[model samples]
Target: MKKFIGISILALLVGFFSANAQDTAKNVTTKVKESAVKVGDKTAELASKGKNAITDKVYKDKEGPNGETIYIDKHSKYYWIDKKGHKVPISKNKLISKQ
Candidate 1:
């Protein structure tokens, strides 16, 4: 009976420890994913800025529908860079002139 009690206690402790370890691992994974997303966003923003500066014209006195900076591509197409670094095309009439 004593040996059985000891084994039961050991099993409970092991189960608790394994559950705690899984929680810690999940937390770590979540944090790592968050960090990766942040890094990717920053990298995309920098790349967009660099590409725009080199390959497009920045409309210093204008903005987009969401108040984003405006860029005119080689084809005279107006656009704005979104958070994911994609160009959101806009009409020239929709541009907001900055004061």
Candidate 2:
């Protein structure tokens, strides 16, 4: 009877450890996926900025909100690059003139 009890206890401990390890592995996988998404977004933003710098015309005396540099694309649409490197459209009335 004592031997049987010892074997049951050992089986329970093994099962508990295996369950704990699975949870830890799932948490690690979630963290890695989040990190990969952030890196991809940053890379896309950099590529957008590089393309705009090469293809758009810059406005030397005009500024955008928060002092962002203005640009005119091939379509003659005025815009400014935001912190995330997205082009934010602006009207002539909203432009800040520099002295």
TM-score of 1: 0.89
Q: How do the residues 17-88 of candidate 2 rate in per-residue lDDT, one tens digit apiece?
A: 999999999999999998887887787778777788789988888888678788889999999866566789
Where does candidate 2 stray beyond 4 Å? Answer: 60-69, 80-86, 92-99
What would the per-residue lDDT of candidate 1 be over residues 1-99, giving only the tens digit for each residue? Answer: 999999999999999999999999999999999999989998898899789978999999998877899999989999988887888899999998887
Candidate 1 backbone overlaps, count: 0
Per-candidate TM-scores read 0.89, 0.70
Give the candidate number with the greatest lDDT: 1
Residue pairs with backbone overlap in model 2? none
Q: How many backbone clashes does candidate 2 have?
A: 0
Give every collision pair in model 1.
none
Worst 10 residues of 1 by lDDT: 79-88
For model 1, the stretches where C-alpha displacement exceeds 4 angstroms are none
